[model samples]
Target chain A: MDVYLPVAEMAVSPWLMIGLGFFVGAMSGVFGVGGGFLMTPLLMLLGIPAPTAVVAGANVAAAAATTSVLGHFERRGVDLRMGLVVSIGGVVGVSVGALLFAAMKAVGADEGLVRVAYVGLLGFVGFSITREAWQALARTRRGEEPAGGRVRNDLAHRLPWKVRFPRSRLYISVIPPLAIGFCVGVLSAIMGVGGGFLLIPLLIYVLHLPPSLVVGTSTFQVLVMASTTTFLQGSANGGLDLFLSGLLIGGAVVGAQIGIVIGRRMKGEQIRMVFGLLVLLVALRLAADLVLEPALMFSASPPGAGL
Target chain B: MTGLFRIILAVLACALAWVGAPARAQNRGRSAAGIDEAVLVTSSFNGARVTIFGTAPTSPSDLDVVVLVRGPDRPAWIGERQRFFGLWLGQKRLRFDAAPTYFGVASAKPLGQVAAPDTLALYGLTPESQLAVQAGDTGMEPEERDRLMREYARLRAREGLYVADAAGVQRLPGGLFRADLQMPDTTAPGLYTAKVMVFRNGRQLDSTLMTLVVSKIGLERVLYRFARNSPALHALLGVALALGAGFVASRVLRRVSVT
Candidate 1:
C-alpha cells in the first residue's frame, strides 16, 4: 500500500520502505553499528528527497541501536562506563555539527558539502576494512594469531587524562574515546550517518577493548548520538518526516533481531570482509556520481528548501 | 414592402448587438471552461486528476485544445558540479528570480505543432517560457540563455514537477472536450491557475482562465503549520517520538524475537 508522507509531501510504497528498513537493520545487527550509512543512500536511490532520507536514516538508527544494544546486554558484555563517557562527547559534537549545518545552509553549501564528505569518508573506511579482513584471514590460515588480534600502539595510548575501564580490562586515557566520539558525532550529524562503522573500528583498534565489549559499547553510544541528531536536525532544520521514519523504524526493529541471531552463526572475519565491501560499493557509487555528467544541465529547487 | 423589410433587418441587428455586447465584455474574449473543483483541500492528498470540461465555439475537430496548470512562483538556484582540488563540488550556477513550484501542461497534439514557438511563449504554455533567469545577462548571449532554459525545463520535467503531455486533451462527440491532468502527491499547495486555449492552424484563437486553490486541510494542515510556525515544538515532538519508538521497538522485539 501507498502511504502519504507529511513532511516530504509524497506518497510512497510502504512495503518497499519496510523492506529497505529490514535490509539496513540486518546489516546494523550483524555489525553492531547504526545502519545510517547504508540507509541514507538506499533511500536516496529510491527517489526520496535527500533531506528526508537523512533524517529518516537517523530515526531508523535510533530504533536499531536500541534493539542491538539490548541484544548485546543479553549476551552479557558491554562497558557502560566507557559508553557514557563517549556519549557525553558525542552530545557536544552533535550540537556543534548542527550549528555548522545551519551556517552552511545559510551560505548555500550544506548539501554540496555533505555529499563530498560522504564520498571521502566512505572510501577511506571501506578500503581499510577490506585490507584488515584479508590480512586477518591469511593469518588464521597460517596458524598464527589473526591480524589486529591485539590493539596496536597509537596516539590514544599517549593521550592524557587516563581512566580505567574494568569490563574491557583497559587503562586508557578518557581523551581518546571522547575525542573520537566527538569527531564521529559531528560527521554523523552532517552526513546523516550513525557513525557505528567508524566507531567500532576505533573501539577495537585504538582503545583495544575486548571484542565482546566493543559492540555493546558502540551500540549504546550510537543510540544516544542518533537520538540527539534526530531531534536537533528536525528542530533546527525541519528535515524530519514522521511518516517516513515510522515506516522505517517498524521494519528495522524486527530485522535487527533476526540479524543478531544470524550474526552469532557467522565468523567475525567473514562479517568484517562483507561489511568492508559494502562500504566500498557505496563509496564508488558516490565517486561515479561526481565523475559522470548529469542528464540535465540546469536544475531548479523550491524556495526555502535549502538544507 | 422592400423598404419596410430593410428597416426591420436594421432594428434586429441593433437588438442583437446590444444583447451580445454585455456578455462579450464580461468574458473579455475568453472561451468557456469549467473545472471539477474550485478548492482542492489536501488532507491525505495522494494527488488528483483534475478534469476540465470546456466547449470551443469552432468545430471541435478543427480546433486544438491546450490546458496549462501553473502553481505559485518562487526563487531558486541551480549549481553545476565541477572539479576543485581533486574533489567534485558545486561551481558555476544559475539563479531563477521566479520559478513555479509546480507546472503541468497538456494538449490534444504536440504544443509545437498546435502553435508557433513565439505564440507558445507569449501564452506561457511552455516551461522554458515560464522561467525568469536571475543571471539575465551575465556574459551570456540570447542563444545561451535559451539553451540553459531548455535544460532547466528538462530538469524540472525529470523531477515530475513540469510536464507536457500531448494526449492530455480528448475530443468529444459534440463541440465539447475534456482535459485531464494528474498532479502528483508532491504537488505544492498554493494558488494555481488552469488555462485552456484554443488554436487553429498553428495560431491561438481564444483562451480562458480558471483559478483553483490547493491548500492543506485537516491534520496535515495543522502539522505543516506547526512545523513552519513553531519549529521548536516540532523538533521536540520529533525527538520524543523517536525515543519513544526506540523504547517501544525494544520492548516489542524482546517479546517475540530476542530470547
Candidate 2:
C-alpha cells in the first residue's frame, strides 16, 4: 500500500521504504556502524527531496545506534564520561553545521553542489577504507601479526590538556577527541551521515582506545549526533516526515536484530571487508550520477527546502 | 443575431466583473462560477480532484470554458549547469519571484485558439504573463527573460505541478459546464484562485473567479502549525522520537535473542 508523507508532500510505497530500511539496518548491525551515508543518497535516488532524506536517514541511523549502544553497555565497554564530553562538542558542531546547511539551502546551492560534494566525500572514504580493510584481511590470512599502535600513543601524549579516562584506561589529552567529535559532527550534518564510519577509525587508530571500547564509543557518539541532526533538520527546515520515519524505524529495528544474530558468527576482519565493499558500491553509484548524463536538466524546490 | 450577442456580452461583462467591483454583481441571474467546496488538506492529502461546475449562456459547443487554477506565488531560481574547468557547475541562474506553487489551466478548446493573446494575459493563462520574473538581462535580451520564464513553466509542467489540458472541461447537457482540476501531491498549501473565462468566436465573452482553499487541516494543520510556530521544540521532539525508536529496538532485539 502507498503512504502519503505530509511533510515530503509525496505518496510512496510503504513496502519499498520498509525494505530499504531493513537492508540498511542489517548493514549497520553487521558493521556495528550507523549507515547514514549509504541511506541518505539511497533515499535521494528514490526521489525523496534532499532535506527529507537527510533528516529521515539520520532518524534511522540514530535508532540503529541506540539499539547497539545497549549491547556495548552490557559488555561494560562504554565510557560514559568520555562519551558525554565528545557528545557536547558534537552537538556544538552539529548546530554550526546546521546553520551552514540552512545558509546553503537559502542560497539554493542544495542541488549540484551538494551532490558533487557528496560524491567526492563518499568516494574518497570508500576507496581508502576498502584498501585498508583488504590489506589488513590479506595480512591476517597470511598469518602475519597485527601492526603495533605506537605512533598514535606518541601523538596522544604530545597533545595538551591531558586527562584520564579510567573506563578506557587511557591517559591522553581530551583536546584530540573533542576536536575529532566536532569535525565529525560537522561532516555528519553536511553529508547526511551518522559519523560512525569516520569515528571508528579515529577511535581505534588515533585515540588508541581498546578494541572493546572503540565500537561502543563510536555508537555512543553516533546515537547522539544522528539524533541531534534529525532534530535540527526538522526544526530548521521542517523536513521530518513522521510517516516516513516510522516506516524506516520499524524495518531498521527488525533488521538490527537479525544483524546482531548474524554478527555473532562472523569474524571482525570479514565484516570489515564486507562493509568496505558496500561503501565502495555506494561511492560508485554516486560518482555515476556526477559523470553521467542526467535525464532532467532543470529542477525546482520549495522555499527553505533544507537547513 | 449580432446585435443580440453584443447586448448579452455587455450584460455578461458587467456581471463578470467580480474583481474590485462588487456593486456590479447586482444581477440575480448571471453567468457564475463556483466549486463544490474548499479542499481540506489533511495528513493523507496526496492530491485532490476539484470539480468546478459553472453555468454559461447560449450554445454549449460555441462557448469555451477556460479555467486557470493557480496557487500562491513564491521566489524560485533555476540554474543551468555548464561544464566549467572540468567540473559541471551552475553557470547561469535565472532568479525570479512570485512563481506560483501550482498552475493548471483547463479549457474546452486549446487556449491558443479559444482566446486572444491580450485576453489570455489579462486572465493569467500563461506563465510569462502571470509571474513577475526578475532575471539578469545584462548580456541577454529582454526576450531572454521571457524564454527563461517559459522554460521555468515547462519544467514545472513536466513535474505535473503546472498542467494545461485543453480537453479537461466537460459540457453537461444545458449551459452547465464542469472542469476537474487535479491538485498534485507536491502542491504547496495556500489560497488558489481559478479564473473561469468564457470565450466565443475567439473573443472573451464573460469571466468569473473561483477560489480553492488548500490549507492543512486536522492533524496536518496541527503538525504544520507546530513545526512553523515552535521550530526548536519540534526539533527536540524529533530527536526524542528517534532515540525512543532506537531504545525500543534495543529492548526488542534482546528479547528475540534470548528466546
Candidate 3:
C-alpha cells in the first residue's frame, strides 16, 4: 500500500522505505561508519531524484547517529577531546568541500569528476581493508600473530598544530585529524555522503587512533555534519522532505539500536572485515556502472518541469 | 364549398407525401452505406471540466455530451459566491465533494466535421460521481471505452487538470482540441479511466475511454517493502552478518599482532 506524504507531495510505500533504512542502519551500526556510501546509491536506484535523496539520506543518518551515540556514551566509548578536535577539522573541510562542489558545478564537471573520484576512492579503501582482513584470518588459522600496520610518514601527519589525544593514548599532532576531517567534509559535500566509511579507516590507520574510538568518534562527527547538512539542504534547496526523513529515520533508529547491541558482541577485526566486504561490493558496483553499458541513457527534465 | 374541400385535401396529401418520402430515403440510405467509422476524443480528470472532440455527419443546433468519471472519495467544490464569504468568516469551510463517479462533454458538431481545437467542456458532472479510469485493467468494449474517455476529458477540463495529448485521437493538420481542466490537489493516487461521448443533432453517435495513473515517491515507498516482509528475520540476519564479520576481524587482527 502507498502512503501519501503531505509535505513532499508524493505517494510512497512505507514498507519499502523502512526496509532500506533497516539495511543501511544495520551496516552503520556494524561498521561504525556512515552508511552514505550505500544509502545514496540505493536511493538513486529506487528512482528518487538525486538532490532529494542526498538530503534525505543525510537527515536520516543524523537521527540514527544521534540515537546510536547515546549507547557509545553509556559505554564510555567516546573520546570527547579527539571527537571535538576532529569535528573542528570536519567543519572546515565541509566548507571547503561545499565550495569545491559549487566550483565543479560552475565548471560543469561535477558529475563526471565526482563519479570517477568516488569509484577510485571506494575501490582503494575496499581492497585495502579486505586484504588486511583476509591476511589476518589466514594468520589466525596458522596460530600466528597478525601484522600491526604502521602509519607511513605522509604529508597528512606532517602538518602543523598537532594535539595529543590522551584517551586513545596517541601523542600525534592534532593537525592530522583536522586535515582528515576537512578532507572528509569536502568529500561529503561533493559526493553527498557522510564520509564516515572513509573517516573511520583514516582515524585508525593514518591518525593512529585506537580501533575502539574510531567508530564512536566517526559517529559523533556524522551526527553533527548530517544535522548541518539537513538544515542547509532544507533551507537552501528546499529538497529536504521531513515526512520522508521521518519515516526512514524511524526505521533506522530502531535498526541502529539493534546494530549497536550486535556490534558490542562481535570482535573488532570481524567488524573491519565485514565493513571491508561491504565497501568492496559497493565499489565494484559503482565501477561496473561506469565501465558497463547503461540500460538507459536518456536525460529527461527534472520533476515539476514546464510548470 | 366543394372547391374549399379540394384545396384542403390537396394540402394534406402533399404534407403526407413529404414525410413519407424522407422515411423511405433514410431506410435506403442505411442499407446502401452501412455504419460509418466515427471517431470521438475526450480528456478529463476528477473535479475538472471534460473536453470533448469528435467528428459528426451533421451539425446539430444544440448538442449535449455527457461524461462520467469514477474514482476514490474526495472533497466538494464551493461555488464562487461561497468562497468570497468564506474568506471573511475566518472559518475556512472546506466543502467536501464526493469523488467524481461520472463526467461527460458534449458538442454540436456533426460526426464528420469534428476535428482538433473544437473542444467542449462539460461542467455538470459532480465530484461525487467522478470515477478513476484504470486504463489497462478495465475490460470495457470500444464504445464503453470511448464514453469513459469523454467523461474523463470533461471532468479534467472542468477541474483545470493538465493531461498529455491523447494518442488515440487523430489530429488533422492545424486542427486540434485544447481544454483546460482543474483537479483537486488531494485527488487519490491511482489508475483512473475516462469515457467520452459525442452528440450531433441531439443524438449520441460514438464514445471512447482512456486510462491514466498517478503515483508518488517518498520514504515509505522506498523502505517499507523490505521492512514489512521480514522485519524480525532481516534484523536477525543483519546481526548474524555483523557477528560473522566480527569473528573474521578478530582472527585477522590476532594474526597481525605478531607482525
Tens digit of lDDT per residue, candidate 2, span B1-259? 0111121101101112221111233233254554424666655555666666666654435767787888888777665555545555554667775688788899877888986788787767887676665644335566766667777788788667788898888877755667766666667777788777766677665667767676767777776677778877877776777678778878876886689
The per-residue C-alpha lDDT of model 2 at residue B242 equals 69
The residue ranges of model 1 lying beyond 4 angstroms of the native Cα positions read: A99-117, A146-158, A292-307, B1-27, B30-45, B59-64, B83-88, B135-142, B171-174, B199-206, B257-259
Quality class of the docking in candidate 3, CAPRI style: incorrect
* Best candidate, lDDT: 1
Model 1: colliding residue pairs = none
Show what share of the native A-B interface contacts model 2 retains: 0.50
The sequence of per-residue lDDT tens digits that candidate 3 reaches over residues B1-259 is 0111121101100000001111234322221111121111111111223233333222232333333333334332221111122221111111222434222222223223443222332322333124333444246565644454454444444433423332323322322222222233323444444444444443344444454434333443343333335444423332233333333433443355447
Estimate the Cα RMSD of every predicted model relative to the unseen true structure: 10.0, 7.5, 20.2
- List, in the given order, the native-contact fraction of each candidate: 0.47, 0.50, 0.00
Query: Which candidate wins on DockQ?
Result: 2
TM-score of chain B of 3: 0.30
Q: How do the predictions measure up, each by TM-score?
A: 0.85, 0.87, 0.59
